[model samples]
Target: MALMKKLTVLAGAASAVSYVRKNPEKVNEAVGKAARFVDEKTNGRYHSQIEGAVRKVSETTRPRTAE
Candidate 1:
């Protein structure tokens, strides 16, 4: 049962990664909106952290180009 649960979680994560890779523009837009929302909610207390997280996520999800 534990193995099954782990497999399920891994599969879901893989699917999410695939979707992000395929729709990087949309993912980045949503990430930006989410970061803005969080920043506003926190009154800019964590603006830098939010921006950094957004940058990291965007970089990770960006589609790779062929050489």
Candidate 2:
């Protein structure tokens, strides 16, 4: 059972990575929505941390341009 769960998680991670690579804009949009939800739920208590995490994710997932 544990092995099955791990495999499932790995598969999901792979799928997410592929999706991010293919459509970084959509990924950023989803992250923004999640950040807003957290901010509202916490009444802005963790605003800075959430914003920082979102910025990092956005930077890491952005599509790379060719020279």
Which candidate ranks first by lDDT, i.e. highest? 2
lDDT of 1 by residue, 1-67 (tens): 9999999999999999889878888999999999999999999999999999999998898667999
Whole-model alpha-carbon lDDT for candidate 2 = 0.95
**How does residue 38 of candidate 2 score in lDDT?**
98
1-67: candidate 2 lDDT, tens digit per residue? 9999999999999998898899998889999999999999999999999999999999999767998
RMSD in angstroms between candidate 2 and the native structure over all alpha carbons: 1.7
TM-score of 2: 0.83
TM agreement with the true structure for every prediction:
0.87, 0.83
